[model samples]
Target: MGKVMLARRAAIAALLAMRRDDLFVVTGLGSTTWDVASLGESERDFYLWGAMGGAAMIGLGLALAQPRRRILVVTGDGEMLMGLGSLATIGIQRPKNLAIVVFDNGVYGETGMQPSHTQAGVDLLAVAAACGIGARLDVSDAQELHALAERLAHFGETLFARVHIAADDPPRVLPTRDGVALKRRFRRAIGIAS
Candidate 1:
């Protein structure tokens, strides 16, 4: 198969643009974090700087705790691969308001651009399906991405998608690194006692 046509920044911008006020976003470390912060910081956005493989689990926790709000977990293929078991856990938990979107550029963009398993033919969509996530998608074009964007707006089921983006690195857009402050801000935004 030929390579995917989507650009990482464009895809992320499109996705975040569709986010509603109640949407809770958790981004994985490295490129995905940068991609999210690039759209401007938000109290609803929790950017992971160190927990390399825990984004989805954190999203799951938030989804369970705040069942009424939509939760979106955005991460890169490399990070997702490191925490592959989270998929099965999420599949079992099956939060109706949770969605996970993987930016699969087929490389570990932060670690010297090493080729990832996605580049070696590991299909994440298939894994999600096998893990029992009912709503799974593999996005490679603008139309499909738009469709995914729409679904994210009114999410009602556990959703997973691996978006194939270009391998080129974009300028980093870093968020605040203070975990305590981020936690307090996120709690306040969600109306929880910090």
Candidate 2:
């Protein structure tokens, strides 16, 4: 059989379908941010607008601060490549509640679809494994995606996955752009008074 390339929106929808109330999400800028917004906005979602390579670090901080809640970072391959060092830091910190999912379409979706390192044969899952992330996965089909989605809710260790998605641009679904409002809402969602 030929390789299976998952659709970005469908993959994201499945992953979020089973999201629990305590799941905290940090979305990288561009496509990933759009994907999360498409699923429907929530106070638990922290959408990054300008921090190009900081999603994982933001997730790490959130994971550290709210140890009881599950932290998920969804980012595109370009963003993940930019913040590659964050993986090493996360590996060292070993936050059991943290998981990172990269939608690797092998291109910079926001930047005119230029081929990315993943397209050049860079394996992010391997890098994550090298950084000591124990639960590393490369999802290329629907069944694997479903299993990965299920694992998101109950993951016990720091996990990372690179999901191969189609390189098609979908309609952009935007969330609130006000930084203060987002911070306030997220803080309030986690039980912190603004």
Candidate 3:
């Protein structure tokens, strides 16, 4: 597996082991990283539009609505940068039930080749920490990720994990589903049917 996928898969497995039935996940296109890692019968996966940066906000809503439940947001670096302001809101809210994980592959993988904010020298963890969310960086192997997962279980703070995903082209798993169809499915997946 590629770097980003590897890290995400590890993280996903960790999330699954920690919480299965009482969790919420906000995920975008690049979430194929974690999707491939998810196991049988999980209704908690709230699929998101490629509407980059919206995932975290969605996670925030879920956390706020169900303040006692844990919410995890798996997003791409490109998408998070698109909605960086969401971090500020999350910071102010300080929802202890939320964790935001950004897979920093440094490219807008869904689109044609283009650099993301991370590639442009943006330290998202620093930016997030400045916004008041607890931030951490993961660059080591699977053991470190497992340890992080254990830590995630006990932290009652808004957490941000910036994972340095290896630079790889986005994976092709669902065949090239049309953009419109994908959006519709995503809306349904997240129960935002309109």
Candidate 4:
């Protein structure tokens, strides 16, 4: 049988349910942002409207600034591929509170579900390990997702996770697009006076 595929929306919702208020989230360009926004709006979520491939770096910055809080970067494979170089930089920085989770549906959902590099033999998990992020995980099923969510609370090392999700486009549920507002609210949530 083919490998089991996870529903992106469901998986994201499951993760967010376990989220601690202080755990800041930085979302990537399209669906990943929408997936998080769909549940509800929160000051802790810094949703990137059009910033493709920049999520990981943003998370790294937040992680460094708020060493006591966890920073999670949730992005898609296509977005991750665009910012592949950031992985190397992240490894060098090695922020213990930062974790990046790529929702690998193997397609660029924003551009109409075109097959992406991941579909053509790019192994993101290996790339992450190569970049020196020692803690790597491959989550394909519900069990793994649950484990990943649980692990999110306790990780103190730079961690990378690739979640295999189905290439199904759900309705676009967008978050606030004003970048300035996003920055202000996120800053306030993290205890920084904006």
Provide the overall lDDT of each model, using Cα atoms, as 2-decimal numbers.
0.93, 0.92, 0.68, 0.92
Worst 10 residues of 2 by lDDT: 1-10
Which residues of candidate 3, in runs, are more than 4 Å off? 1-11, 14-17, 31-41, 135-137, 175-194
Alpha-carbon shift of residue 108 in model 2 (angstroms): 0.3
TM-score of each: 0.97, 0.97, 0.76, 0.98
Query: How would you encode candidate 4's per-residue C-alpha lDDT over 55-154 as one tens digit per residue?
Result: 9999998899899999999999999999999999999999999999999999999989999999998999999999999999999999999989988888
lDDT of 2 by residue, 83-140 (tens): 9999999989989999999999999999889999989999899999999999888888
lDDT of 3 by residue, 1-194 (tens): 23334545554565457664455666766554345334442445655545666888888887887777778887888878888899899889988889887777778777775887788889888989899876565644566666666756765778888766656553444332355664555446545648
Error of 1 at 113 (Å): 0.6
For model 1, what is the alpha-carbon lDDT of residue 146? 92
Over 95-171, each residue of candidate 1 has an lDDT whose tens digit, in order, gives 99999999999899998899999999999999999999999888899989999999998879999998989998998
Least well predicted 10-residue stretch by lDDT in candidate 1: 1-10
Task: Output the lDDT of residue 135, model 4.
Answer: 96
lDDT score for candidate 3 against the true structure: 0.68
The clash numbers for all candidates, in the given order, read 0, 0, 2, 0
Flag regions of model 4 displaced more than 4 Å.
Answer: none
